[model samples]
Target: MEAGYLFLVGPFAYTKLGKRANADTMDRITIFCFVASYTLALMLELLHSWRGLIAARIGALLSGLAGLVAHTLFLYSKQPPLIWQFSWLLFVAWVLVVAYLTGAIHYRRLTWGIFVLPLVLALVGLAVLFGQPPERGLWTTYETHTLWGPVHATLLLLASVGVCVGFLASIMYLFQAHRLRTKATPGTGLRMLSLEKLEEMNRRAIWAAFPLLSAGMIAGVVLLSRSEVVSWTDPRVLSTVVLWLLFAVVLFLRIASFLRARQVAMLTIVAFLLLLCSLVLSHNQPTGG
Candidate 1:
């Protein structure tokens, strides 16, 4: 349990390092170590569930340490390691943990885990399956004058996370709504938020995320226009434009339904689904991938 807690803490500590100049290497190494540790711990827990062996527990702890050492060695040898990739992984892990811990989701939501884990596994699997390649010369053509690219990416990622929360909220809302409609007592294992509160939370998350997403999309367009490497006609570019339009229309409809909170909540849910679909499509696209 302590080891699992540490595994969770490591990623957040590394994220805080984003503010410092010499923090890149340390942050990357920390994230690599944390993932490796968490994976080991999870494997051990699974084994323990299966075999009920003390040695398996010990193996879990030792594997975690071994992973840390391996990651350290890998980082030491690579020149100017690609830190951002590691950071992204850490951030995603942090969000998942937060979601689980908050009771915003229940343990039975392992099905949700089944949905998200494959994506995370695919990313980590890609990293392990393909060794790091040599760094090419600085692609100045891709660089833009706006310092906003990183900000935009960060905010968009945050907004995406918020949308995920909204998704969960919607699920809970629907579950509770169903119970009310049928006059069924709530089940013991699956606890859900009050319909009113869930709706409030869903609406708030959308309201907060919309502005950040809008800013990110606008800044992204500006940055791409200034960057010679990116073309306006690129499928990736067009997809983003389409996504933004969808979100914008959703936003407009949500605001128009100011008097009807239920309508707003439903619109938020629909918008989040559209955004998620866009993300999946974009990620699967050759240019975006």
Candidate 2:
């Protein structure tokens, strides 16, 4: 049972099984309930795209809220009194879903669902597949116990969510751009955010996310500086540095001149994908000596 308190300080788990953790011990009903809720919500959103129905919007809202509630319950059930196993990347996914839900309610815009739900589904899928309970004989390393760990974690998580929201906005921008360029009529079922608003959101997500991610990477670099347990040469560290630089370029270009909105959107997508890959590499690290 001691092995089960996996993320002592951080929200990551490392083990020898490598590719993905064994998920047999997880709570299936909670998983199923939230997954089904999000899936149904996504479907309703798609239906709105096709039919332009307000009822579909209402259904999607209710479904997203239900999913959010189930997600909270799932986490609560796993988090024993003071023990902090809340470090799963799925927790990031949950935050994104909650943010998406919040955006849906605040904006009252169905198009938000079109671009955001797929990513939410992907994050939830990762949560389902790899968010397993640690086994009795599991090989592991705890990254959360240090003072800097939670700060490192919170910044990275916020950055990731910001990038994700930005990504969705980018998709929206592209959709809006396409319609504008081709003079195509929006389908009766689809209502998109204005190009101006989508562009603004894309810009805001990056402006906010890049600095936080960079700070998180810097904190890790500081940790490596004070010890020899891990190397700066580690793929995770190097890739994040590289990821930070890439976004820095985006941030610079975004602020400097007439960098087209389309280019900025594309860059954000690339940066997010790179971050995802780095996370996958970190997730699969061999923890055994």
Candidate 3:
């Protein structure tokens, strides 16, 4: 009778362990699936850059959409809504990709991925490195789930998208500049816009982003007020102030010959890089506090 009880208990324990292991593996798979999906989508986008194939473009679109769906499910499985810091990052990427996909379908801007995917990858990769809540130590204040949380994240991400535009436009400007100096053809192969258009895009992007970024900062203050864990002088807060000030300089200089066009592009690049740095730095603070 004792032997029978031992055998039954032993099997039950083994089954429980097996289930736990399976659950852990599934969690990892979700991350892998979504990340790989984005990667595949990016590769497709690059491939389209060299050879504009309709099938390839369609494949890229599907891959991006699929990755976004997987990302949603991945977050859902971990928590009903977003509980992880990375989710906020991925959520923004998802929104941006959705917007891109819609624009591609509507205006037929198939080449936009060359500009969009780099920003998407940057956000997603940095988010991955931002670390996750411990397997069991997921604790956050009311602000995380409340209106403040989404409001703060959304406004900031929209602001970041504005920055992303500047970044993409800067890249296009440099390329176009090189082509003009070299007296190269704006080939059908190089599917890019004119320098004037790109600069206009950059100017408008920074203008649109400045106010949103400022609002995001204000929202951050409001959100932080509710949370006792965060301090007034967190590196992220200071970094944001600096970033905002730099934009102010760029805006001011735009009115005069304070800086040349290339100088402004360089500054825009620097500003976006600073934004990226702050996203990573924010993780060093005490999480789950």
TM-score of 2: 0.82
Best prediction by TM-score:
2
- Point out the worst 10-residue segment of candidate 3 by lDDT: 2-11
Q: Superposing every Cα of model 1 onto the true structure, what RMSD results?
A: 9.2
lDDT of 3 at 68: 76
* CA lDDT of each prediction against the hidden true structure: 0.50, 0.69, 0.68
Give per-model TM-scores.
0.56, 0.82, 0.74
Question: How do the residues 1-289 of candidate 2 rate in per-residue lDDT, one tens digit apiece?
Answer: 2343333322333443233333443344467788788999999988877877889989998999988887765665454211112234556668778777888888785477777778877877765554464542453334433445445555677787788888888888887888888887764345678899999998898988988988887766666676456676887777778888988898888789758999998888888888777766666442100
Error of 3 at 261 (Å): 3.7
Clashes (N, CA, C under 3 Å) per candidate: 0, 4, 0
Model with the higher lDDT, candidate 1 or 3: 3
User: What are the per-model C-alpha RMSD values against the true structure?
Assistant: 9.2, 6.6, 10.4
lDDT of 3 by residue, 1-289 (tens): 2232222122123333234444665476567787788788888878877787778788988998888777755654454223244655666676677766775576454367767777777777877787664443253445444565555655666677788778878887877777788888666555666788778888998999899888877877787788776677877777777888999899999977688777888899999898777776667342111
Lowest summed lDDT over 10 consecutive residues: which window, candidate 1? 76-85
* Model 2 worst lDDT run, 10 consecutive residues: 79-88
**Cα deviation of 104 in candidate 3 (Å)?**
3.4
